[model samples]
Target chain A: MKLEFSGGVLTAFIDGEIDHHTAPSIRETIDKTILQDKPDVLRLDYSGVTFMDSSGIGLIMGRYKLISSCSGKIEVINIPRNMAKVVKLSGIERLGRITIKED
Target chain B: MKAINTMKLEIESRSVNESFARVAVASFISQLDPTIEELGDIRTAVSEAVTNSIVHGYKEGKGKIYITVSIFENAKVTIKIRDKGCGIENIEEAMQPLFTTMGGERSGLGFAVMESFMDKVKVNSVVGKGTSVTLEKKINGRFVTKW
Candidate 1:
């Protein structure tokens, strides 16, 4: 995961598969960034993500709760079509905005 | 034409093997020339099933996870993930979305994701004995039959 903070938004470029094995590191990295930076918006860019399972849902939910506590927002962008389906099926869109970044 | 092929893999129930399991199954199914979407679905479902075996099934110590993949001439694939860990006590309750026993850390959508991605999902478990999750998906019509 690559992170950049600009204009009160922390953009996280998550690459590779997001599963139980990788979620913890991703979570810790993102959580630490969120806690320290306290950005108004956390934009998660998923274009580089090849695969994601339910663990990705948990990661997103956990971030949503953390950001919400600080009055911040979460935006999921550039989600791959297949990953989008899993996100939608998990009903994660209700917790945050999911925008497909056009290629 | 009818053809049947079966392959079984046994791996240690560790979190790291989750990715290995998915990639192995995905590679095995590639013979059907599945689309990216189809491959992603199968990979996601396999990851979920294997993760469940490692995290919830064998919570305390190391165990063995068995993955069986069967491919049919009609391009239908069946995957069975089994573990000799602590089987679920309540199958019905466990299938519920967002009902994880691991508190808020787990989303409890493992079964949900499997059901969504696969054509059929069946869970058979006997507490203290083990749990087996069977997933089946038919390749899209656009797929080519290589074998």
Candidate 2:
């Protein structure tokens, strides 16, 4: 995961497979950034991710809780097609704006 | 049903081996030439089952996770993931959506994903013994076939 913050938006570029093993590090990074910058929006970019399960959803949900308490919003963008179904299944659309990755 | 091919895998319950476990099963079943969507679904389901063993069963401790993949003659596949860790006390409560013992980062959706992605999910556990989750799915087999 890589972070870029500007204009109160902290965007996390998450790549690779998200499982129980990798999620903790990714979560830590994002949480640290959120705590430090307290951005007005947390954008989770899933464009670079190749594989994800419910762990991905957990990551997003945790962020939602963190940012909500911080009085910020979130945007989950560039979701790859292969993972769109799972994302939709998690009913994440209710939490933030989702922009699907174009083929 | 007779198994056309079969493979067994055993790895310690570590986060690093999660990808390896899922990908190996997908590759083993690739002989049936499953579609991309099918492959993705199986990968996600397998990941969930394996993760349950690592995060819940083994509880961030050291234990071995056993996995077996079998491809049947009718283009059906079954993957069994087992662990010799602390078992679930309440299978019914555990399978509920958003039900997780480890809160916060845990989504509590592992079993839900397994159920959604696979055609059948059978879970059998003994509190002090171990837990076994068997996932079954029929391959559309659009890409190739030797049978």
Candidate 3:
């Protein structure tokens, strides 16, 4: 997964599967960006993502914790519905807008 | 109603390459108009399962993890993940929330996350053979086909 930071949005365009192995890097990348850039909106665009598991869940929850402390908002766009069901059940709908795009 | 289809992929238990997979699966399944919370739930659940296979099953060694998915006639989705590593001794105890046999850097929320996301989750393991997990969810009102 590659993370790009610009202006008030810290965007991460993740690819491949997100599990425990990938969470640390993702967390580090986003954390560094969030701390350094301190963006108002942390956008995670999942246009390239393919697979994910619960550790990926932990990643988002952890990010939510970090951004919440700084009063920053997190938005996840272009999420697939299968993953969307998992995210919605986690009660993260209150955190950001989850949109499904046609491919 | 259109006939449902199935998709399957086998991936290395490496964490570096899963982000793209997670995003792709999430984006593909988003036709159901899932909420952000639901997306997070699915990602977290998948993460836990894959991570468990990597850390616990393979112990960071090289191994193959099979992830198979199926979509039912009603747009229901099911994923089957399997690992041929050190299997579980007891499935019942393992499924308990906050149970961690690893005892390091883990909160033991894996099974909990999986059960929370998919409509149904089934796990089967043998002490010396392997482990398999099946996750299911219903995707309603989507017209897209399998990719």
The numbered model that scores best in lDDT is: 2
TM-score of 3: 0.58
* DockQ-superior candidate, 1 or 2: 2
What is candidate 3's DockQ?
Answer: 0.21
User: Candidate 2 vs candidate 3: which has greater lDDT?
Assistant: 2
Candidate 1 structure quality by residue, lDDT tens digits, A1-103: 7999999999999999888888999999999999999999999898998778888888888888899999999998898766777788888888888876566
Question: Over 4 Å off in model 1, which ranges?
Answer: B1-3, B141-147
Q: Which digits, one per residue and each the tens of the lDDT, describe model 2 over residues B37-127?
A: 9999999999999999988899989999999999887788999999999999999999998898988888888998899999999999999
How far residue A46's Cα lies from its native spot in candidate 3, in Å, is 18
Task: Residues B1-147, candidate 3: write the lDDT tens digits.
Answer: 343655667888786545544555667667666566656656565666777777777777788888776666656777677899898888998988767776533546788778876688998898767899887777543345343
DockQ order, best first, reads 2, 1, 3
* C-alpha-based local distance difference test score of model 2: 0.92
Candidate 1 clashing pairs, residues 3+ apart or interchain: none
**Model 3 over residues A5-88: C-alpha lDDT tens digits?**
777788888776666766677778888888988888888887776655555556666777788788998887876655655455
Error of 3 at A41 (Å): 24
Best model per DockQ: 2
**TM-score, every prediction:** 0.94, 0.97, 0.58
| Stretches > 4 Å off in candidate 2 | none
Q: Point out where model 3 deviates above 4 Å.
A: A1-19, A22-103, B1-3, B28-37, B141-147
